[model samples]
Target: MKRLHYFMIVFLITGISYAQELTITGMVTEDGTGTPLPYVNVTVKRTSNTTNTDFDGNYSIKVNLGDTLSFSYVGYESEEIKVKKNDSVINVTMSIAPGTLEEVVVTAYGARKAKKSLGYVVSAVSSESISMSRSERRKARRASKKSNKSLNKALSGKVAGLTISNGVGYTNSNSSVKIRGANSVSGAQQPLYIIDGIPVNKKDIAKIQHIDPTKISDVKVLKDKKATSLYGFRAIHGCIIITTHKGNYEIKNNESYEEIVENSFEKVRTSPLSTFSIDVDKASYSNVRRMINNGQQIPADAVKIEEMINYFEYDYKQPKGDHPFAIHTEYGKTPWNKETQLVKIGLKGKEIPQDEIPASNLVFLLDVSGSMDQANKLPLLKRAFKLLVNQLREKDKVSIVVYAGAAGMVLKPTSGINKNEINQALDNLDAGGSTAGGAGIELAYKIAQKNFIKNGNNRVILATDGDFNVGMSSDKDMKTLIEEKRKSGVFLTCLGFGMNNYKDSKLETLADKGNGNHAYIDTMQEAQRVLGKEFGGTLYTIAKDVKIQVEFNPAKVQAYRLIGYENRLLADEDFVDDTKDAGELGSGHTVTALYEVIPVGVRSEYINEIPDLKYTNSEINRNFGDELLTVKFRYKRPQESKSIEMIHILKTGENKVSKDFSFAASVAWFGMKIRKSKYINNDQIKDIVTLAEENRAADNQGYRAEFVRLMNSYQTL
Candidate 1:
């Protein structure tokens, strides 16, 4: 009986211990800031069970009661907690492990490797060291007003074989960093910067200066060949790998676009004149395409029919006379509506040889805000700008200005002949902080004005996701600011990147009011297309303040409507007013517009018949009875202020339209269908597809073929 009781007691104890072996979950954060510490090691004392804190610093492990749980990080003090019977969640706060070096170091692609196993020399600065340096600097500043120092200055003596030099005539904010001395005689000597697995170009180095010192987790300097062998020739000078704390900001879907109101038919006798500013911005089409390709719902406001139609290039005759652009008009039956006719108007700018083009003084205004931390934002932007850098000439000059919490210059007016210097500056850019777009614009314009090239292309190219959260962020405010800057003779070009929280309306306003163009880059192909193949067209302006006014003949037409250009519509008087701002025409660029017209005799629901006027003359002008309509264009030379006018009269006759017209019409139809226009239905999608397929003429670039595929994909969706 005694033996049986002893065995029963042992069994009861085993059951209780097994019941206590529940999973324990908790989070590990910094001692005082409550900031989570990712990749912290967690282990059950004296057991094989072990794990590491995830990206959010959360961890889970199974342990019996009375078992000890230990948490440890490279720069943080190790922590031990004894598990109790009632303890299901154990949260730990780790203090900094002062003066302690990390046993493991982050290598290529963010993989952690033991330092002792490395074959080459690698120097590292722990988070504790960086924090301590910042603290000391703050104390010095408090003691002396002249002790103002930047992070670069604070880090000057922290690592061996690293040199930090103050940029001449610039503040400490522009300090240059070099690792293990200069590696090249003529190339850039600054070490290549890597942030969270993304290689930053040198031009964006200023952005790294803006990062908060406290947010930096680690900084490693790789000095020898074996240390930087994985990074390639760009890292010949060495590499600086920095790991930062994961931001607390969450991704939110808050994309915005300007609302579009479709154009309605108007009677020729009542509203005969149709006036609007020409639009060369093709951002809307690519943005919409990105949405469709991502399988996201297409917003109605995102569809700009005119931009969609103009996205594809059309074949038009070259300008033969004194005009900078050649005008071509075509008349044909409308594909969407049999009762209405389509009038296609196209303008092709004169193409200039690259060598003959004027010297360019370009300022790159880049946004390095927290929102741009994604791969498609800053990384892709760097690659895209490199393509443009490759195309620069010896006579041209380039400057770089970046903005985050504030604006600062990363590179001065460096000649394009020094491509290495320019590319090195581009490589150092890192993304963080709030966007100060207004401040960036002001600074970019200042740089462009300071380095103004006479009779040359002086422009500021703004690349961003358009998520301006600080200082003058509203669309109206941006418009006002850009309008004031336009007087400086420095044009603006807005290149939008990324999605979700994208502010299209604000970018559009900036481009429109600043006398420039806008384009959205969704892929590297698009980047090549915009900044590569079409470099001349994307930068050089041929004409400014270009406007179009059309007068429909009452004798030949009853009513007409202009497709798209809802926000670009101008008062009839604005067409002749040179003081009013309008669209710009770039070299080698083409612009297209379409009008749907209803004849005087056709009965249509788009128009209502009115009784004959009693006092007005209802008789048609017999002298110009054969005339269909008249088109008048007003434009100013790139340097001229006064407007030059040109007129063309289209006569009423049977005309055969080219494949360009059919293709453009098809694009407009597809846009309308996507927008769910009241006049267009799903049934017409087939016709649009067929028309586009048939008119895919000489599609050397295969852009038309891509469009056909897009249409077919949309049909299934």
Candidate 2:
């Protein structure tokens, strides 16, 4: 999906370039003084497509053989020209009529776009000024307080209505955007960001998550309600259009495998893993023996247990250490103290390069719901797929299945390596009807199965707002149905679109049950980052039914609980039993998890002063320093029938403290404080921020500055 998007710039630009098309190149000038009309806008008529004249009023445009071109400038009368297959260049001298140059401006409320165009927003960024910043100073406002003092300085003057203010840190989380000022105070106001037209997830917007911005060519902000209406409800907060120049518009694929090759780290523990024992909550099973051992009470209603659990926070351990590339870590600071600590880990072993990843059969299950008429939903879906189409290799295939009032195939299994045919299919998509989500999923899966990849990635990528109101609507029923199909080897990746009817939970179910991942496409940069660049991780699967179990040592830790991954927990028995299912892992993907531990001596609310008499017969206490916990992982080889297990012990005080983990812990701590999680202290935000900054590393240091900026903006709170 991502690779195709990068390819589209090529497909869209050159897609017509090689189409036996006509090139209309000429110089515009006044008939008398022969003065150049610099910056005059030229449009290819019927299509609101356009570009501007250069300083010398020289212009070059690509058009189909029989298309007509239109020309306009602030003070020039607009002219139209028709071109044919054999005509190469066309030149014209302008005769300006008085008052003919009235500028056309689009405005409605606080939003603005040229009334001359519609479909997607005209959000744009200067081509010559593109910069590579880890924490993309999303707003022109103060990205860092130390450098840009005023909040307005970071992002204010640059993007209209796009404000990037808050504190001075990487994870302020509070910094916000109100595209047209509070459309709905209760809903997310961040505009839908379309890169070349695909929606990207908001959480993936940080500097280090994924995608290299250096590959990006331009950015467009779709702000006005009109600009966003293509996606209907999702555009309540507006939208952004991002176009990566990888394949289109002459942006060379600048980053080589070596350059984009992420720095690697040493595994904190890589010994041959040990096996784990399973433990299920008493009520979760029907195993008569285990039930009797625990003396559990039976329930009248069926629990209808999931065959395999697809929880999100199994805390896969990354190889923790400084990058072997440059050794970025400070000698004294442990992994636990750095503000923006990055545990750069690559695949346990190379599977395949991005370009060389296996052929895939992709079925895009799109929801063209009534709520999706706003700019970001259906429209972005088309744009995003077009971007994905641009990246296809000869072996890749694509199929699009759209559902709203009824389900139907817009395009069959066609090679993504092919463009025009796919674009024609995409160009015809229109949004209407109630969401018949379940029907769409069924059709998509059917299409994917028809083009199923043998020993490759075969998946249905569902893009929708998840409002399955029309038929087969219950989420659980849909989940159960999808789960059964995943056994057939067709994975799923759920892409959520629209805001008012956005169902994160439902999309989550599909991704989990269907052996895939969920990402919210809120921007095009995100789409490029995901589909164009990280195509393998986005498409290929290396491991399936991945489960992790951490058994804490009761002796060393008094009380402890994992945080955030409420959805990812596994019963201990499920961890070892080959038959029990778990989450799937993509090649070279990184998953993180954290735990808030209350050490043995820090007694307060966690411990019960009086022990329960039920356990009075316990033996004498032993060593408390052996191990804090043993980390166990169970997963099926990307090419296996059963699961395999690996285990490592994580002892308390075993951390050979690196500033990276400490800083990351601080950042996560900041998030806990911001979201006001149960364990974090509001009063301690300042201290945590200070700790993160003080422990920050010198390598790729911009993230630290961002963290500081976020802190400054919210420290007052």
Error of 2 at 5 (Å): 44
> Can you write out model 1's per-residue Cα lDDT over 666-687, one digit (the tens) per residue?
9999988888877652346778
Per-residue error (Å), model 1, residue 483: 0.4
TM-score of 2: 0.54
For model 2, state the Cα shift of residue 485 in Å: 1.7
Worst 10 residues of 2 by lDDT: 253-262
- For candidate 2, the clash count comes to 94
Per-model TM values vs. the true structure: 0.67, 0.54
Best by lDDT: 1
Root-mean-square deviation per candidate: 20.3, 20.8
